[model samples]
Target: MDRSRTALIWRYAGRGLLLTPLLFLLVFFFYPLGSILQFSLAPDGKLDFAAFQQIFSRPYYRETLWFTTWQAALSTLLTLGLAFPAAHVFAKYQFPGKSLLLALATIPFVLPTVVVATAFIALLGEDSALNGLLMKVFKLEEPPLHLERSLKIILLAHIFYNYAVALRIISSFWSNQSQRIQEAAQMLGASRWMVFYRITLPLLLPAVTAAAALVFMFCFTSFGVVRILGGLKYATLEVEIHYQSLSLFDLPTAGALSVIQLMTTLVMMIVYTNLQRQMTQPLNLQSSRQVARKPRRWAEKGWLALNLIVMSLLIFAPILALIERSFTLGDGGFTTRYYEQLQENPHRSIRAVAPVAAIQNSLEYAFFVTIFSVLLGTLAAYLLSQKTRFSRWLDPVFMLPLAASAVTLGFGFIITLDEPPLNLRSSYWIVPIAHTLVAMPLVVRSVLPSLRAIKPSIGEAAAVLGASRWQRWRRIELPLITRSIAVGATFAFTVSMGEFGASSFVARPNQPTIPIVIFRFLGQPGLANYGQALAMSVILMAVCAAGFVLIERLNRAVIGEF
Candidate 1:
């Protein structure tokens, strides 16, 4: 009777704990989303569809939407074309420095979009070192590369940012795929290309399609890259939303665009999720050790070396260029003047924060964002791990933030939280709150699998032995999932450190984050300003790199999920 009563109590307690994440979603996610809809559909408290009508009727908005679609499609195709062969190499071979190469490939995916854009500009901008070298060598008066602020640059940046998503997904999936079928086909005298086409291609379609969908979603909503590299010519929905809401103060139109983007991404997420579920279904899986081998033939060695060189150039060249350019001057001398300028505030501009101060502010914000995200996201994971009806449907609801654009979330925060009880427009906590919202989805995704993998029998046995619920959780469940929690926390910290789109809206001018500082420096003219921007970007990149390294050390097996 006592055990039964205890079980009942624990069950109720678990249900109550589930409410925490729901309340968080209500106040932060759903409330803000509702406010956006309300503002757009019924500004001045009267029903109106003019915003929607304008978006549909206007050629500019139509062209923006069309451009957004085609660019995303092109990026998806280009990334797949480049990453597919690389994925094959990573999956089917054992090479020296393989682990390090894979890790380096993934770093770009985690970097801030602003940093990615900055890296490209440092490498290919008219005043860049590459251009300068070419001009000097060829005796040309003008820079040969005109890729800056062009569609080509935007597409290139997207490829750089998203290459890892396809590579990791496909490689990880392919590594486990059984070789028996292919081997059997080869025994029957099929050519290598024929085997790949007839057997391997069909099997890999799900992973490739899923990767394509996710890459499309990211490029479709791209803001920082388009805004920085595409200049005034290109505008994705995310950029248009930012322009309308913040620049023009057209809250209604921005909200409409947000709704359109939100619906589109939600559909893409659904497709991706379904495909991922297909990937997780039972299969005749094989270990990488059984499938992968070192190159034995000269031809194989040459192909491997060629792929490695291409991957290295694609992933590392821009970063190296950015680092070198940060320390280089027009006079062909290297100096630390740019780094030194980070500490001084010569202009004393109210809108500008010192780079040193910005760094400090980012660390503090990241700390709190990590705490909030871990607590809330862990709770959400716990809730979703249960077998109850409530948990089943709630799983996708928790993932809604992943589908929602960060820019839209920021705009929603601006309009929704202006009242007395929830007023946080100018509060210090606002930035952290917004960041927490963005980071929590990642935390939930990282921790959920670990929680669900825990056998219920162990917890039942502990309860049967008179172990209290809290004691069982603290002693057994906590230790078992600590690594997963750490992974989530690290991701949250990294994400908070580099977040730009949402930060642009919520971060105060006087207390800007590192990305904001970099953006400001980039917007200003002169070589000194450009150099400072590069310096700040390098600092942010280093922080993100360190965080990723910690995560890599924590669990290499789980990094693929990221």
Candidate 2:
């Protein structure tokens, strides 16, 4: 009876580990989700399908849904098409600056969507110098390239964002395939085509599927790029949700769309999650270094040189344009006028805010999110280490925020947390709270892998040696997981700095995020305003790149998944 009672106490204690994350989910995630879902279904006291009826009845909703899916599908295809070649280049070739190139490819994915849009405009917009030069060269009256405010730009931006994810996933899978099989097949007179189709492709399918699913999910929920680039002509469900809730004040429609977006995202995420599990299954293959060789043949040399030029131009040209435009005056001479104007209240009529304040706000919010995310994520990771059925089920739940659209969460803040006991609309804490929802998932995923790696027998051995639980954690577990936690912190910091969709709904009027401020600057007319937008974008890009590099180095000491 005593032993059973003791076991019960320990069980409850172990279950207590989940309380923090569970409460966070219940209050912040579930409550807000329930509020939106309830608004859609009930609206009043009694249950009704009026929102659904309105949705199905309206051509607007149908069109938005169609465009969202259509664009997302196209984005996924383009990203994959771009990624396979890049991944192949990295996997098969040993070259100088390969790691540097790979890292640069990843930079776009980590950047705030607004920054990317700004860069694209600076490089490809009708008024851009590049376009102007091209027009002069071609003797065209109008700017020949009309890439801005169109689906083409949107597709390109989506590819930029997802390129790294596809490359890493596919390359990792690619590297693990044994070269012996290919060699053996070649010895048997099998063609490279036959070997690839009959062997290599079959092996690569799992990782490809996982990467594609995630890319689709990201493209499907895309907001910043679409909103900034697509403008009034295109509307994804995310943009539509923002429009209905904030613009039109149609809560019912917004609520319904949020639910739909959430459901679709959840399904894709679940699929990716399952496929990822399959990707990690043991593969009997050689390291990439063994298979990789320097460019020898003319074709190989040409391929390498072509990839170098294409990737460099793709990643660096836009950024260079942004920098150039930020400096160039209306008369075309370089000046610090745009950068200098950041200190003053440039536009009084339009919600005037100092550029410095916006930077401070972004940094402070990022710091807050990093601290909170690391703490909550550490606790969640601890719970995941328990290895119970509940823990297994709970693993995916932590990732729900990653799957959920930022706009949906931002809208949830307005509809639920704005009133009564949960009233946080006026509080700046709400911004960090929203950021935490997004960041926490990354934190948990980063740290959980490391936590699960630590054998419980080490803790048991420590316990038998008279080490307390806290001491064991401090000595053994903390040391092992610190790098992962650091990785999560870096991700949290970057996400907070760059987050736009959720911050859009929750950020106070005068108090705006960096992305929000850059967006505002982009909206105003004038070369200086445009230049300032570019300058601010340059600043943000620098910050994210620096933080990513530093934190990435920290994670290299520990074997943890991003």
Candidate 3:
């Protein structure tokens, strides 16, 4: 009877742990989101659907809405088609440096969109090396590769950003699938194409759907890439919102856009969750390592080489091009002039910031974001790893920030946090707090997998061996959780560093981070400004690469689908 009471008491105590993160999220995330809903829908102390009505009735808003949907849909399709074969190779084959290659492919996922835009420009822009080569080869006066500021370029960028998501998610699911079914089909005289068409592809549908929904959501709310690369000809919902609120100071229009984007994202998030859940439904949980082997046939070797070359070109060419452009001068001579200017802050009057100051600010913000997000995520991980009554439903709510537009969150913070006791309009801490909303989900994802892997028998064994509950935790749980925490902290730092969405809204003009600095430079004219943007982009990529290297080096034992 006493033991039962003690267990009951501890269950309630464990449940009480959720309150901390819940309260924090309520204040920072939910309250701000609610504030945006209120501010837009009821601007004059009265509810009205006029803003939404205006959006549908106006040609500009209607076009943006249509473009956002179509672009996202097209991007999703392109990404899936491009990524499917790569995912297949990763699942079925073994290769040297496979893990490193996979990690390299995933680096783009963590990069700021501005950085990616700059990289693409460096690779394919008019004066780019590839264009130089093409011009020389074709003996043409015009640059042959004219991808800049085009819908084609936008789709390619989306493919680059989302390639790993499809590869990882689909491969992870595919690797666990038993090979016997496919082998049976082969033995029954089915052609290779027939086997894959009827058997392999069908089994991968759930994961494919999940990846598509997620990729679509990302492309839908895309702001930085479109703003930087889309020029004046294109506008998505996110771009429209940015222009409305920041450029035009049209709050009602921005608010309506935010609401529309939020609703769309919510629907996709639900779809992704349901589809992903279906991916883990009990099946033959077999390992791929035993089934996977290296290529031997000529056709197999050709296919493997093709995938490798294509993936490498897609992933590394932009980065290499950016690095080269940063050093290349007017006469095509190598110079460090652009990098040298990073310290000068020469274009501050035109919104350009000192690169060093921006780096320091981003690092400082990332530091606090890591601390706050890890703490909140640790609590949430505990709730998820245990048998908490509400954890199942609460799990997806924690992921809302991942799906929500950063611009919307930033705008929400602007209106909500600028008044009353939460007057954080000028507070330096606000950016990191805003960043924490996104970073928290990363930490939760990183930590929860390891937490869930803990066997109950380990604790029972410690108790039976005369260790106190606290002692068992100190000697057992803490060490196990520490690895995940370290990785989670790295994730938090990376998220905060590359975060442009929330930072776009919260970061002050003069006190901008690296992405903001790069953005400001890119938006302006002149060769010097463009060169500086490339230089800063290289720097940002280096920082992100280092962070990803750190993450990969850390305990990859902590595994979960993000």
lDDT of 3 by residue, 18-132 (tens): 5688878899889988988887799887998899999999898898899999999999998888788888788878999988899999999988899999998888888788898
The reply for model 3, stretches above 4 Å from the true place, is 1-18, 347-349, 460-470
Off by over 4 Å in 2: 1-18, 135-142, 347-349
Compared with the true structure, the alpha-carbon lDDT of candidate 3 equals 0.86
Candidate 2: tens digits of C-alpha lDDT, residues 1-562: 9968886887688667657887898899889999999999889968988998888889988988999998998999988887888777888889998887887778888889999999889888977889778878998889988998888999988887788899899987786677888889999999999998998888899888999999999999999999988889998999999999998999988999999999999999889988888877877777888878898999998988887787777778877887887887377787888778777785452487888789899999999999989988889988887868988888888888888999999999899997888899889899999999999988888898898888989999999998876688799999999889889899999999999999999999888989999998888887767777888898999889987897668777766776
TM-score of structure candidate 1 = 0.95
What's the TM-score of each model vs. the native?
Answer: 0.95, 0.95, 0.93
Residue 148 displacement in candidate 3 (angstroms): 2.2
> Order of all candidates by TM-score, from best down to worst?
1, 2, 3
lDDT of 1 by residue, 390-445 (tens): 88999899889888988999999999888989999999999999998889988988
Higher TM-score: candidate 1 or 2? Answer: 1
Put the candidates in lDDT order, highest first.
1, 2, 3
In terms of lDDT, which candidate is strongest? 1
Q: What are the lDDT scores of the predictions, listed in order? A: 0.91, 0.87, 0.86
